[model samples]
Target: MSDANKKAIRTAIQTGIGVAAALPMIVAASGVPAALPWVAGALAVAGGVARVMALPVVQALLPSWLRTDSSASRR
Candidate 1:
């Protein structure tokens, strides 16, 4: 797969994992499931690992898309 695709997929996975880890914690503390904390911790760690593995591969293959201008063109 291309670098751009890999980067985007990694980003999406990271976002999903973060949300999964947060939602349960935001629920009623008294209603919290016994396994909620473990699930969240697992997701966070998985996402972190995926990021560590995918980011360098993507960055190395992708090119910079940003632009810089010291001054704007006179119009």
Candidate 2:
């Protein structure tokens, strides 16, 4: 697969995993009901954001918050 496609897929997977992990905390902190669908909804939102950010133009224009060194090219 092309690198762009790979990147997008990777981003989506990571976002889903992250949202899943945070599902409990987000619900608890927000005092929202701990219904199962809330977790699914959060993951959907995160996935959509990741998809938007996966666009080449958006990726190019946005500085990655997790970057340790901004000087070099990212993997």
Candidate 3:
């Protein structure tokens, strides 16, 4: 696989793990009826953003300044 594909997969897995970890807290907060819409909207937007960030095209287009390369930082 190409580097872009690997990066995309890594991004997706990281996002999935994050969403999984946050699921219980999100579920607990859903008990508030008035806050349900906002919670759902936030989840939808977050999911959309995660999905977008995982795309190869987006990965390639991302500015280098935003990247956090640990090896580079250590130098």
TM-score of each: 0.36, 0.46, 0.41
**How many clashes show up per model?**
0, 0, 0
Model 1 per-residue lDDT tens digits across residues 4-41? 99999999986875665565455435475646777557
Best by lDDT: 2
> After aligning candidate 2 to the native by TM-score, how far in Å is the CA of 17 from where it should be?
0.2
Native-to-model Cα distance after best TM-score fit, residue 24 in candidate 2, in Å: 0.3
Please, what are the lDDT tens digits per residue for candidate 2 over residues 14-66? 77757765655777798776566866677566667666656665555556774
lDDT at position 37, candidate 3: 79
Candidate 1's displacement at residue 38, Å, is 20
1-75 per-residue lDDT for model 3 (tens digits): 999999999999878757855754776776654357776676666667667766655655655564344333333
**Clashes in candidate 3: how many?**
0
Misplaced by over 4 Å in model 3 are: 32-75
Model 2: lDDT to the true structure:
0.66
* Candidate rank order under lDDT: 2, 3, 1
How far off is residue 75 in model 2, in Å? 25
